[model samples]
Target: MAEDRSEQEPARRPGGRTARVRHRILEAAAELIARDGIGGLRYDQVAELAEVNKTSVYRNWPDRTALVADALATFSADVAPLRDSGDIDADLVDFLEAIAAALSSRQGRALLNVVGAAHDNPDLRAVVDDAIAQRLATLSQRIKAAIETGELPAVDSHLLVEMLSGPVHLLVSRGTRELTRADAQRITSIVLAGVRATAAQHTIALAGEHDGGKTPAARP
Candidate 1:
């Protein structure tokens, strides 16, 4: 029997010419942002670099923040998401490697630059906040899924996100001269160990909660 067509998952949209143009615009914005920060991006300059008219940019993005936000979003979606292979350790390593790749990219550097400039500009703050919030929300969802699947214990997903990503943000913002892949992996391993410990604590607390405040027996 044929499966109900409506019940099947919808296919993803292919990246065609329209997607290519958007990619060009994002690349241009990233370059401009890196050079002059968020304040330096002009529709005219992006249009020129993207080989399109200002009207095209305006047509796609009604405001500067929208354009910048979309660029950040597009860049982020290009990276790999954390996969659950049913092994918590391996999944964490893969997630860390993907994060390292993102941080070392040009778009990632541009994001850091915009964040720095946004600190001084009230108007830019909303734009930066929205972008960061979207990414954090995605991270939280992934963490929650891991918990539901028993791959990880129930934890404060938001706080855990901060723990995992805070180091990368600080390193990028502090103008650290040398941030290598090996260094990133080493830091991630240490952080993952801490996360595992924290998860264990949460599991113990929950067990206590369910067992009328009695502590669980120590594991061998």
Candidate 2:
């Protein structure tokens, strides 16, 4: 009953089979966590859900925490912006929508379950903290890079990430209405408006300093 994907992989190569197997295990873990929370996640259950042997699960993951960490890491990677699309407006809209979709997906629910459990378990909390830190660091770098290229205004990257993601997280994490692509677009528009306004203010302030604190006269 093991779901050996060797034959199902697009490539008949060894690497293809390995990739397929890894995806299956990660997906199985994500689904189990979504359905039953972290307490219900066990190697046996993971093996059953993945349709693989328990030994196979152990051979690949080696530990429970390791499996959970890898699964969450994969989810985070999916949500991160790997490249800029040259159009800031379109790019930001797509970026936020991708985040909304990821966090609301079954895999995202599974990730949140692990996070919720970490609240009381110090050891588990440490592991989850490390995993999240890794996720955030990667994302923060991209935000910083945008600022450097003048695509974004100078602002706290972490704070910007929080502001960008908080609303969607609140609604979805609280079991409220799911965030839609339209909603994501609107949210990005608002945030960008604020950022542009702030950048303009900064420009005005610098101009005032250059002009000995006098307002420049408007051209007729």
Candidate 3:
């Protein structure tokens, strides 16, 4: 009725402005969280850092948990994503390198600290657990595929991930030294070799049982 003001206004593409605003708010939230942990994130600070209206933050995220969850989710996706390149060794080395890089960053360390203290914060615990589970699921899938292709022995994917990632986390958290590509390679090699050898022994043991416990030398 107001002289068709809608038509007079510039056509706004869907999710253009809204998406940019959401991205900015999320980035600001992550930065603040990285600098000061979860307790330090404030809407005023987020609004100021994001350069968006304070109402934008309020309208987008219902509460601190929601905002933190989204920020962590986005951070996880960007930080460390496991990829399978049909070569398990190289793939694992790359994955480990990514982990090292992430842990060395301010954002990554902040997120890890949040996770470390998650036991004290139920809301943060739930969010961190969910994000971690999602990432592990991806790693599990890649490990499963490698097993199927005979690139890896049949092993517990979760344990395998723990084995591979544990060293990186330890080295980075301790500030012992910088993680190098050689370290990633050595970790990958040692773990994979152990897994393969274990699988081989298991297979030989099963074969012995099937052959009435007769050793190869004892056979005709």
Candidate 4:
């Protein structure tokens, strides 16, 4: 059986058709990566899935690594962006919940697939790293907002985000259990408590430093 892009797609983009084609091809590339992992990707498959000419795919991304990189980057950038909804607890829970959902999804598997293959593919690895860093940058801003609003004390935003994300990533990737809302609540509560405790410890240390590093005298 022969697959025809024209037969599969009846409609066409009106303006900036080249851009539209690039987007469709990239989307198809992402889905293929999700379904078959990076090693299984084929240009013809991407073209057929995208309903564009195979030449279009090649023209847009001559390198397979470039194709895969663009696809993953575009997909991650399009995922839901985190927002500070005035409640740190609620927002953190919501954010974690969203992350759990993503990790359990096919796209999440595709992302992990790319990450797993990154060691052997330097170009793809760099693209994936850039994408992840960009996402964490957004999270860093949210943490900053929490700090400025007094919802959280001065803490390491990157480390805080890491603490908040690492456990969930490990659990989900290991297939231990699909995280539920309850899990979200538990994780959020524990991390917030730890953050507060750490902040208190830092404050105490600073206070001691101000006292010329001397032990505070006990008033009888």
Candidate 5:
């Protein structure tokens, strides 16, 4: 019998099987969470849906919170991402459009349901908080960069994000109609204009205070 060199080789490349299993598990978990609130998620259901062993689920995630957190984190990263293309107007428009699209997606609705139910579930609340924080961090960094580069006014980045995303959420959640590119552009334009105007007013106010509450022409 010749030596079985094939048997000596690894069954699969390192991390390949593990990655696939994790992906499937996460996807099944999201679907289940979307269908049934986090309270209804069961390891056996996840295992069966994912086609993986129950032990694998437990081996990877010791508790439901960890599993849900990872699933949401993955969903946020995949579905809603903010990009910086050096054009603040276009970037903001694209970002608003992405948010509208995501909010209208299946997973996005799932996330909204989780948020609605989070008030009663401490574990779910924490998971949602963490996921939201991760998203805001990326958006905040981009807004701050724009401000530093003189592309945007000196405004609270978080507040700006809220103003920009608020309407999208409202429109999508209403289920009345789909958000259009024109809507996104209009939202971006209005918010940016308001921010710039506010910044200019603040600058004018500061200059007046420096001039002992006198206008530029009145100073002389």
Candidate 6:
């Protein structure tokens, strides 16, 4: 069944009719990729799903690999970056919750499937890497913004995002644990504390520098 289109319309491509045609191809590709694993993806299936002719698929993608690459890009675009809502704690919490929700979605699972398939296919791996790179860039920017505002500590933002999400990935991928609300809270607390502690340490060090690195006299 064709999924219900969201109220928000996709932006029009500069190519007018050709743009709509390409968008339909991409939409069809996303649906097929979600339904079938990356290895099972076929341009013919995409054409059938998009309700377009095979010639259109060929003209747009030229090959199965190109089709897969474009499909993965389309899928990546759907997973928008984590936003900064000004409240660092709330933002991080929301981000974690969103991760859980996304991982449970068909599209999210399909992303992992593509990752696995990319392991053997070099070209596909590049496509997957590019998608992941885009996500990581978004995450890194949010982390940096938080740090700049003193909402988070001075740290490697990329590493910090990974640290925050490492457990969530393990939980979903390993099936060792479920991402309960409580778990999300606990993860947020731990990360917040770590960031705060590091920031505090840095502040104390800077204060000491102003005091000429001298130890204060013992209090009575």
Model 3 score (lDDT):
0.79
Per-residue error (Å), model 6, residue 105: 4.0
Model 2: ten consecutive residues of lowest lDDT: 1-10
Clashes of each: 0, 0, 0, 0, 0, 0
Clashes of 1: 0
TM-score of 3: 0.81
Looking at model 2, residue 11 earns an lDDT score of 57
Ranking by lDDT: 3, 5, 4, 2, 6, 1
lDDT of 5: 0.78
Clashing pairs for predicted structure model 3, backbone only:
none
Question: In candidate 2, which residue ranges exceed 4 Å CA deviation?
Answer: 1-23, 58-62, 79-83, 121-142, 206-212, 216-220
lDDT scores of the candidates, listed in order:
0.69, 0.75, 0.79, 0.77, 0.78, 0.71
**By summed lDDT, which 10 consecutive residues of candidate 6 come out lowest?**
1-10
lDDT of 5 by residue, 48-70 (tens): 99887777788879988888887
Query: Residue 148 in model 6: shift from native, Å?
Result: 1.7
Candidate 2 residues 1-220, lDDT tens each? 4356454446547666567677888899989988899899898988787777777788888878778877776765654564576566676667667666777788778877888998887766876666545545655776788888988889898887777777777777887787888888888789878877887787887888898979673332
- Over 76-104, each residue of candidate 3 has an lDDT whose tens digit, in order, gives 67646777778989988988898788767
lDDT of 4: 0.77
Give each model a TM-score.
0.68, 0.72, 0.81, 0.80, 0.80, 0.72
Q: Cα deviation in Å at residue 209, candidate 1?
A: 11
- Name the TM-score of candidate 6: 0.72
lDDT of 6 by residue, 114-159 (tens): 7777888898888877776665566678888988997777888877
What residue runs in model 3 are displaced by over 4 Å at the alpha carbon? Answer: 1-13, 79-85, 105-107, 216-220
Error of 6 at 47 (Å): 1.8
Candidate 1 regions exceeding 4 Å error are: 1-23, 54-62, 120-123, 136-138, 174-181, 196-220
